[model samples]
Target: MIPIDLQILKYIFMEKPIYYFKMKPYFQTSEYHDLCMYITNRSDTQNSDRLDKRDYTVFDLETTGFLPEIGHEILSIGAVRMNGNSEKLDEMHQLIKPIRPVPNHILSLTNLSRDALNQAPSFLEGFQRFLTFSENSTLVAHPAHFDVRFLRAMVKRWKLPEYSPPCIDSQQMAKYALPDVSHRLDPLLHYFNIHSLERHHALNDANMTADLFSELLLIMKKEHNITTYSVLQQLLNRQKS
Candidate 1:
């Protein structure tokens, strides 16, 4: 056998053991330090933390355009954490400098100016901060596919290692919970009688989505008796199929 020191050196040089996830973000807070890794194995269905007791990161993005593929880019990110509506946790909002100027319609919608973005972080850094804020929580969004698509697009654009997490789409859940009405955020908020919340702003949008998610969780629990993320994932998977 090789000598112990040499063996260790060989492993270190060639095939280092994975003590922490390689793709983990450059972390921000102590709360997120140990939890920066991507979600690899999902939780158990029956024995894990029930859906109402767990944490979720609801996020939104403002972009220069709709499609990330055709030179569209993210301009801002906003996120908030929720735990069964027990308490409102800290939220994260970041502006990212983009390659393109903000469009007139987009500027009118988001109220963000090019001047503001001049002082903001790069896309990679902003995304890293958002991920750090997310910690190990499940992700949620109004229409999750849009936000997730942006994220995946950024990962590819920046040449960063991949990072995709389990996400709950509040819009789709609203469709399931109240099938008769449109699943758009503003309409759902109106249907649920959630009032006074602003729209278009990223942070406001994220919080609004979280509120909708909380309402839907109650409906899901009562109607389907669903109580865990695993079960929710299974249900969502079936819907996709």
Candidate 2:
């Protein structure tokens, strides 16, 4: 029979546990500690946290396919940090190795080959890096409902602590700002007079989405008087209802 100490050592070395996740006693290193705190401590009553005063992480994900529920996995993540509406701060782009084979259409759409992604980091590593880059910032995505759902699905699958940050859907915001205009990213790019980037590639999509979000913010401020985060969230909540 295996001794207790031997069993513990086997779990540590042979079983391959997530260092910070399950090994809390040996190493109490929670990588997501600050991110969780920031989101948790955010005051619902802070009405003065205006849109222009906040920092944002505008992000895009290129996945094998939609529907994370069916095992469609993320292939890449790209993001850019921005202060307020316009000032771009930093960027992060990382490829994630997926367990399943990449589909042909996805390859064409994202311009990512399996060979390229085989050399990339695993999903856990890539996600951790993304969280670090996005720490303490409100998250913005063109269609945040879809993007954020994928994020939540993956976080749950990985057994990581739940991360529910304040998220803004730029597409939804665009709908409110310009009721007559098409809300899709391509159309909005043309509408905003922003130069087009390579579509579907994660980083390029993120960069383009950042531009779209900035344009939407300016329009919202002028047309809707949505100058603060509270006002914007209220607008979004109202739209939902």
Candidate 3:
């Protein structure tokens, strides 16, 4: 029998200041570059001149807290499928049960009660479903680096071998799109004239981010002349250098 507790603990880490401090800078290292390149290149998405002609899977994760290495756990996952024109095709949202009781603060922040999560899918089950939700599309997320880390942690915790690329990050593109403004999701949504479905809800937030990403894609293509996923990755990689 798989010790679920031990598998859960694999996602949590002993708080190590050294690793935490140097994590962001690590993205600039050649080692990180090579790893990301290897995984992303293995994907079969075809290159296209029109940025809007490629489909993407925009997703989001709501966690118990910020630190993935500690006790922070993914509480829910929300995803939306977009067509070649960036139109929403379908969606999936799963509330996940954590191994422990959720704190009051998290409950208040996410408005997800213990009773609610208790009825939801377990971590392993929910995560496997999320992989299926992704299909063969490029994963899109706001501040993708943080979410992707938690995702990779999920695979690690479950002892599953999964290759994850640094997904197409809307925040990075936003920084390039609206360089002199706030890149926070809520404010950006307002800037783009997008109405918020709800705040702090994983599914709603994913929907909002998906809309925001579509808007940013237009900006990236027109302003920076980036028109495909390949170019977008190359462009961001250059910024990392």
* Candidate with best TM-score: 2
lDDT by residue (tens digit), candidate 1, 157-218: 54455566778887777777788989888888888887646678899888888777888999
Candidate 3 segments exceeding 4 Å error? 1-50
Locate the minimum summed-lDDT window of 10 residues in model 1: 15-24
Native-referenced Cα lDDT, model 3: 0.74
The lDDT of each candidate is 0.74, 0.80, 0.74
* Candidates 1 and 2 compared by TM-score, better number: 2
For candidate 3, which ten residues in a row score worst on lDDT?
14-23
Tens-digit lDDT track of model 2 for 175-195 = 888888998999999998999
For model 2, what is the error of residue 65's alpha carbon versus the real structure, in angstroms, after optimal superposition? 1.1
**Alpha carbon lDDT at 57, candidate 2:** 91
Model 1 CA lDDT for position 181: 88
Q: All candidates' TM-scores?
A: 0.79, 0.81, 0.79
